[model samples]
Target: MSNRLLTYNPETEGAEGGLLIMGAPTRAAQPQPSTELEELELGSAFLEATSTSELASVVNRILRHGALLAGKPIASQVVQHLGARLNRAGQSVRTLLAPPAGRSDTAPSEAMERITGAELEGLSDEDKEFETARAFVRFAMEAGRLAARAPSTQPPAAVATAAARVAARRHAPGLDFVQLVPGFRARRAIRRQSFA
Candidate 1:
């Protein structure tokens, strides 16, 4: 009978006695879907929306999807806060589309004129709708960014204001249109009756 010798090769064996095979190819990780593509698709959907309700639906879907992706359900209060801000923006767009009461021939209100200058009256219906949709998308993006953080870290109004500021910048850079769109505190008091 012949005796066989067993060898423990340090290079092929782990310190804990587990075999460590070298040169073995590991499985590749699956690729994640691109957020930029998703945002582009959402933006297109927003632009294609024919009505305010349709646009709201798209916004809701986006916010919910964002919450899900973040692994945290959005609070109802947060949703309401966002809805209120969106309503303000929608009202602003409606106002822009139709001239103020008893002032059909004239431009929009003095406040609107002050905020947007003469450009307010020059925008066609299509242009107004496009700008409104763009503002909504920008607001939604900013809201999603804020919502990703711990809910208790900031108040809903603060979050809404921050998002609205970003949206306003996207809507009309270097303009004070945020007061007309989201109606921040300074202007909100002045337009409280109109909003109601």
Candidate 2:
């Protein structure tokens, strides 16, 4: 009986053995792309942007990609809000580059110039690039703050209820006994006999 139990059945074992021998060679798992590498590539593309419109487009693409990566509706909202800021910043850059018909070129308003520290008119290419990068960094900081403030998906009431359930479970060690025995009471009744 032991020999019969130990003996491998050809009908069942043959197929598995054959499959193991004939199986395709396994490949090594590939590593996932790093976010830092992606950020570097995006930064390079942003720096290469020639015009304000191009810059804004690059920024928009970055924000959209971020929103997709986050995989949340609030992330989409952050993208929309930041996208508007990027557009406004681009418009400001354009204004700084070429003052409007009525506005004097020498005295560009503080609000318009605030986005970019230096005047775009006479700065070197490197300086202009630095200013643009600085503006983007500022925008990114604001985006970080906004994302941090995103509302929780669960309602406050639901969160409180979940916390209360956890607390009850933790505090009541013998609750299972009271629940399992219908007639069992947590407190025992005391009976007193008076001396005659």
Off by over 4 Å in 2: 1-56, 64-74, 98-105, 108-113, 116-126, 152-196
- Weakest ten-residue segment in model 2 by summed lDDT: 187-196
- What TM-score fits each model? 0.46, 0.35
Clashes of each: 0, 0
Model 2 C-alpha lDDT per residue in residues 1-196, reported as the tens digit of each score:
6854454434323433321111221123222322655655665666667677787777666555543443433344445544554455444444454566897645543322344434566666555544544444334433332232234443322222222222222222222122222122311210111111
Pairs with backbone N, CA or C atoms under 3 Å apart (clashes), candidate 2:
none
How many clashes show up in model 1? 0
User: Model 1, poorest ten-residue lDDT window?
Assistant: 22-31
